[model samples]
Target chain A: MGVVFETVVISFGILYRYNLFKREKERLAFELEINKTQTTLQLIATQEAERKRIAEDLHDALGGNLASIKMNIQNMAPGNTQLSTVVGLLDKASEDVRSISHNLMPPEFSETNLKDLLANYYNQLNNRGSVRFNFHTSGIDRRFNKIDELMIYRIVSELTNNILKHSHATEATIQLIYYEEYLEIMAEDNGVGIAPQISDGIGLKNIQSRVNYLGGKINIHSNSFGTTIIAMVNYKK
Target chain B: MGEKIQLVIADDHKLFIEGLQSILDNHPEVEIADIAENGKELLEIVRKKKPDVVLLDINMPVINGLEALKYLKREFGQIKVIMLSTYNEEHVVEKAKAQGANGYLLKNVNKADLIQTINLVHLGQSCFPYRLPAKQGLPGISDGFLEQSNITKREGEILQLIKTGLTNQQMSEQLHLSIYTVETHRKNIMQKLKLRNPAELMKFIISNNL
Candidate 1:
């Protein structure tokens, strides 16, 4: 009886130790995943800060110099044909540089008119002729915090960019539906769909992280017929 | 002319200052009263020259643009300030506006807009070149929120000293206060800013562009 009781206690001890180790392993795995996501988000934030710095430099330093040069030329020769030609060329160069800088750093976040911002964003895509975009919005009359607006803008922008790059379909649609509790964003492309075994590339990861940053939910539906990404984020007012 | 618009252009970049001078060279109603490399010198020149308009850069070596604006408007209310910033971060703009800045213009503004904005500000019209979205209602530095929080001037000074890596003893010496007084001020600042510790305070400062 004593030997049997001792053996039973040993087995129970072994079982408890194994369960503890397994739980620890699972916790560590979960922690590693969280850390990876955090690192990716930090990287994206750093990239944005760097881009803003560079864009501002380009817009201020080089663009300011060009404007000063144009001013000097205008002051030097108001009606001279040659100077006018140079000014015209300078004007074109200035516009091109401005567009590039603006693209790098989207317009200031305080632009209150969502419709206007969307219009400008879509108009910018006119340079890329192959992609046809249809944008629609509803129930978006209320204002959102600046950070929230920027995040939403970035998500839509990235999703549209992905569709343009990966989707073979010539047409895409982006919709923003605002409800009392949350804002729903949808991007759909009628082209080749994402594969099931596809790894999370930088683009998808960026979208996911952005959605995570906004404390939102994301759903993706992909098949041979088409692909669509739907994200819902609360207005962090 | 009856009187040229007296202008003091304060920027750390000498070349940019020169470029701005050249742009304003032939203007009929504007004159370059002085050029300052930093906020300290800008304040000195403002005191001496009493310029009608001060074109101040946001990023400077000693004392940033927002602080200078605060001091300038507080000391010389007649002098109009137009902030010249390379980037239009919304918080910075809102802060400048709240600090009594007469106008805000991008550093890359064309000569025409720059001149017009300066003239407008000189004539006592507030101007903001960038469009802030309507309805978001982001608070400014001196917004009602700050007023409600009741952060004192001493606390603000201490917060700035903390940001500059000044120890309590050093801050006390700089501000002509006792070390304990400086410590009290620091504690109050943290409380007013709703920061739990130094790390949180620093994060708050960076995030808020303070």
Candidate 2:
């Protein structure tokens, strides 16, 4: 009877220790998985930052010099007739180059207000200036964290570019408003709105991905009035 | 076509200044007298150069574009200033636009629009990249454009009358739209355009060439 009792006690102790070890192992595994995911995300973010910096450098430095050289070359033709023809050709070429440079990096993001940035961006793409751009904001002075600021900037800018390229919007409005705990950014356009299904354009996906990474809520609405995008991120101290 | 538009650039980034200089060096319509890297430089340039237009950046090393705007306006009454910024917050933008910028151009603006804006602004049109409601001296713009785009011709006329700096009731008396209707339209226009800050719309009207 004593031996049987001892055996039962021993078995229960062994089982309990085994279960404890298994639980700890599982917890560590989960932590490892989380750490790996975080590292991967950080790596991708760093790559994107480097890419943007390089693109900006090229646009500002290389693009400007090239435009100048091309213009000067067009002027160097000997005769008036030749100069006119060359200049005209050069003008087309320069415009094309400018467009390329514009796509490489959005220069307008540096502007102080969203109004001019969208207005300037849309106007450049729409030759006839048919798309009217409007922006309005009301609230206390709010400055977001650096990462949040950059993300918002990219989202608004990328959305505007998408509208210009795809939506055929004749007008766009961007609004920034602060609610209780979040900063909201709204971008809307008066153009052919998106259908129910979102496309696979890298731009849209990129935006969605970025918002997701930031743990922000993005709501997209499309109708006859046009497509409107609302993105909100919680303020982090 | 017009005299090279007198220009002042304010930014905190040295690289951006370099980039701008590279572009300005080749632009036919621009005459960049000097470039400042901060708000202080902007103020100093305003005193010395008194440029026809100042391209002010909102996020600066010191003081900021909004504050600089007040100073520039007080010191240089006739000079036109344009707010250049990265963030498109309407509140801050509206504030800058109202401060008497001749035009507001985005940084994403390409080489051509940059030149065109300066030329148009120099010619006395409030030059903006995209369309803005055309108002005369920002008078009724707050009520007319912001209130509603469904404005009847009479409402427009009345709004224009208001923009010449008229009182709401006075505008109501002028336009057949009941004083209530005029106020409603004004509110509607603002809502549709999402222009919550009338000062910003007013600023947009005053700064850019119409």
| C-alpha lDDT values of all predictions | 0.74, 0.63
Please give me the DockQ of candidate 1 compared with the native complex: 0.06
Residue-by-residue lDDT tens digits, candidate 2, A1-237: 999999999999999999999999999999998997788678766965775676556554554444445434433543568666655665565455455645544443443444454445554444445565555444543456544555676787788777867788876766665555766666767667775465666888888987876778787766555676777777776
Off by over 4 Å in 2: A1-30, A33-37, A108-130, A190-192, A196-201, B1-210
Candidate 2 local lDDT, B1-210, one digit each (tens): 346777888877665566567667756778788888788878887798778888877667678777888898888878877776543334445566677777776554555676777777777778644444432222344454433343333334644564587777887555433454445445534544356777864664465321
For model 1, residues B17-125, the per-residue Cα lDDT tens digits are 7678877786898999899999999999998988899999887879988889999999999899999876544555767898999999876566678889988998899
Candidate maximizing lDDT: 1
**Model 1: residues >4 Å from true position, as ranges?**
A1-17, A64-80, A88-151, A159-183, A186-205, A212-215, A219-229, A234-237, B26-28, B58-67, B82-210
